[model samples]
Target chain A: MIEFIPVLLVIFTGFSGIMINRNIVMKLISLDIMNTGMVCFFVLISKMSGSFPPIIHSLDEMNLDFVDPIPQAVIVTAIVIGFSTLSLSIALTAMVIERTKKVKVDDIEKKVGT
Target chain B: MFLVLNFVYLFILFLLVLLRRLENLQIFFFVSFMFFLPFMKNMDEIFEGIGGVHIVFDDTSRLFVLMNVLVFLGVSLKMRGKKKIRFPFVLTFITLNFLYASADLFNIYVLLELLSLETMILISSGGKVKQFWSSVKYMIFGSVGMNIYLLGVGMVYMQNGTFDLTKILRVSNVSLVLIFTGLLVRTGFFLYGMWLPSAHSSAESEISAILSGVIVKGGIFSILRILSFEPFSSITPWITKVSAISSFLAVIFAITSKSFKRMLANHTLSQLGFIMSNVETAPMYAFAHALFKSWLFILADELPSERFDEMGKRLNLFPWIFLILGSFSIIGIPGTIGYAAKSSLFKNTYNFERFFLILASIGTSVSFSKLISRRPKISGWGGIKENLHNLYFSILVIGGGVVLFEFRMKSFIQSFLLFIVGFLLHRMIGKNLKELRNPLERIEVNLFVISTLILGMILWLIS
Candidate 1:
């Protein structure tokens, strides 16, 4: 359980990067990093019960030592969702560039109607 | 079976992305998925959410689901034939529904991240530097909050050995303070959510409608779900007192804000404070507040500020019906939706806490009264078709909420009296429209934050 502390720190660093950074692409990347940190945390939690993956072979009975399969399945879905979000963010970045010719958030705001 | 339904929705989202070229077909598919959600078998499993079935399938959630469907339909109609933000918008909407359906804490975090990404897209579509900067700030604040929330989740998992809310709730008195603190940060409570005003106010009007209306409510819903799992009565009295005080202070700040949109954003925070104070009120109030507030924000967005001078000069007879209807609904006038929510809210809360509710109601009336005072004079009904449609939509939602929902009649009457008194006081102190500051200053910002903190602390101490 204590091993999850580093993952939390990574998530915090990613958050601070997103907050303090002014560049749009960097902020998006920071968001991705934050997401990666969360994935790590969840995966680690799932593995707390044991290191073995929850799979069965025809030649063997149920393996009691295997870790919980539920968190893994949830994480898989989260990863797919995360990828779609990243792609959407990239698309948004492209649109912002097309319309305003800049990637800096501060520069973009100055051009739009105040 | 419930999990299968969630997967189906997820599958439909993928299909939407694939069919991005066929805009109308994609919208139709999205609508079909929403319509079919209720009928899906084993929905109880998915609806039970990470927290449990009581939080998901309860009367409150049913109302929330209904509101989501209606708001989406309205927004989709407004975007009919517009290809530019369609597919991504639908994708975000699916993610929102997934978040709502999710029972687990980690799933909520994932869904919230998706929401933040979607909102950034919508805001930056306007391509303004200020908007982008605001979105950046929003992203930053959101990340910090979610991270803090993760730490709390980690702690809870460490303590209870499970991330599911129902499982954790069964083991009482397990670091309740840590869990509440983490959730407070995520939900935009007091100190942590300062980024909200800048982000919500700076976004395009329609996007602001979603941000103010639905997104913040998602946070509130998550917190409320946790609180509900363990009764408020079981919690320390100090926690309840602190929340109530914070809400009262937030409402005062809301009333003093100058910009139309910023004022509305503050109002969202203020209402959140009130709802938090009344956690024991049937979760239905929270759901109702989300629906009404979203509708109100959408109407506020459509107030036509660009042509304020011209529109003000040309104000006509029929539009007054909408203004009256909307103001009544928002201010909790008898026979309106606000009345229903306020009545239920007041009844469940401690009578000693009446001052906070009264002040919040006054703040709402005063803020809207400012809008009415600035109304453009009507020249004629030239844009009858557009105005009529807007009026129809506004009335439909406000009327539907009051008539269909069960509200205590006596409480409605009392709340109406409070609204009237507040409106009267506002009229007495009303300022010239031209004299009001268009853009708020740094001084005002400092004052707003300082006052909210001081007031929140005072209320907490006194209570």
Candidate 2:
């Protein structure tokens, strides 16, 4: 139950961060936090049946105690994609900063709105 | 065996990417050949039970695939000058093919992600720094939508122990709501659709054509695929009602658009709202929209600036005729495929739905009538000999109009009345046209995603 608290807290904080922040970079960070929260929840759910890493070198070593491999695999892909998305967003933010020297959402909107 | 054709196309696209010196005509022929290959497929040749990668050749997917080919062909023809966009464009085409072919839930997710990535590349390839922001926003919205979708996938996997859509025995209401909400954002439905016009209209016109015509439909297709299991039949009315309301919002927003391309982009969302509510006629309308909307975009590209109601005045004779035809088809003149798609909706629905659909049609007609109202300036422009691509597209649009017409004689009278009503509405509203053109400001990506999620949850609760 406590583990679930962190998940809910992280997700809620992520949402609040996005809502409260006007800076583009800060929003990107909040997006990352939200993504992390989701990944963490998936990993938490996979812990229900077992806790060991989902790996086996020998057929005899395979048992019911082994962790579920699917969510882990899926999370890895999600993390890598999340990393790419974050970096690309940062690069775009840097470009926006270079052009107008403003990273706040309202400032950017004012400059580009016409 | 036809399933392997997508891989083969991908392999060829990969080779072309590496080689980087292939002629454009060869690529066009290759695309044409692959487009025709699906027609050769037997309906029962579905490949399943192979490591969770199932590919089914159903009627709806077939229609979408053909529409994909048609728009792609037009884009290729228009892009004869720019050889660089071919790589990402072909990559997008391959992902779309696989997206349509995919039968499982996870496969759809993966393919959709890949398609978004390819589209991101395509959008940024325009090289304007402004385009970079739009491209990034598209990525942000797309990834968030997919991640939310992944949560629903996880729930379904936990409950059913399988990712294969065909093998899944049941879907809980929570899972249905999650999946539907995620896809709602992806499909650019009403509150979630703020990002669509920016990403779609800001790109180059050819890219805009594909984005409007094909990419957004990926979300609609996935939603349809999920509901095909018939596990949550009770959710149908909710989806239809939401889509209808969204469609009305789309048109109202579209009427406020200031530019031709942006107006078309908003109309794409509005038309999607129509397509979403009418599942049986979705493929037909998707095809109809791909043909006419892309033709309209390609024609709009020939003009310098894309200001609303301006291009109609200066367009040459070749584009003038084609533009009129395209707008007519979109407005559902009795002889075109749009008539078939639109009238079918009105035919099967009940009293309110029929009235709602007719009102939507009137909105469509009024909007498109704005497109064709300007008097054509005849002189000083070159003839049909100079612009062969426009001529070719015109032929295809006309041929498609003829082959796909499904007009009933009675509905033809109804369509006439709708046209007159729409014209009268247009006159009454014409004086306010300047104020009606709404230029939407760019919403922050993270806030947009969060709000969309909350809206989805509200929809889930009510439904």
Best prediction by TM-score: 2
lDDT of 2 by residue, B1-463 (tens): 5667657756875686658756674365446567566564557447776435577778767767777776787667777768778777877877787788778877887787777778888877887766777776777677667767777777787777667887887877777776776777677776665678777888888888888888887777887877777664556777777777767777876776778887887888778878877667666777777778887877777665688645444555555677788888787777766777777766766665555666777887787767566556665556554466677666776777677666588788888887778777877885466635333335554355556556666575668
How many residue pairs clash in all the candidates, one count each?
Answer: 19, 3
Interface RMSD of each: 6.3, 2.8
Q: Could you report the Cα RMSD, in angstroms, for every candidate shown?
A: 6.1, 2.8
- The TM-scores, one per candidate, come to 0.75, 0.92
lDDT of 2: 0.72
- What C-alpha lDDT do the candidate models reach, one value each? 0.61, 0.72
Instruction: Compose the digit string of candidate 1's lDDT tens values, residues B1-463.
Output: 4446556865775685666645563355456457556554323443444322222444444445555555565555444455677656667667666666656667676777677777777776666656765665555455545555565565566556666666664433333543455456555665546566667777766677667666676776667666666532355454556566666666666666656677777777777777677666635556556555655555554555633333453344445556656666777776666667777777777764667767767777877676565445544664754453355456655676658566566775677677777778778874533323323222124224433543464455446
Candidate 2: stretches off by over 4 Å: A57-62, B29-31, B38-41, B49-53, B309-315, B380-386, B436-463
In Å, residue B295's CA in model 1 sits off its true spot by 3.5
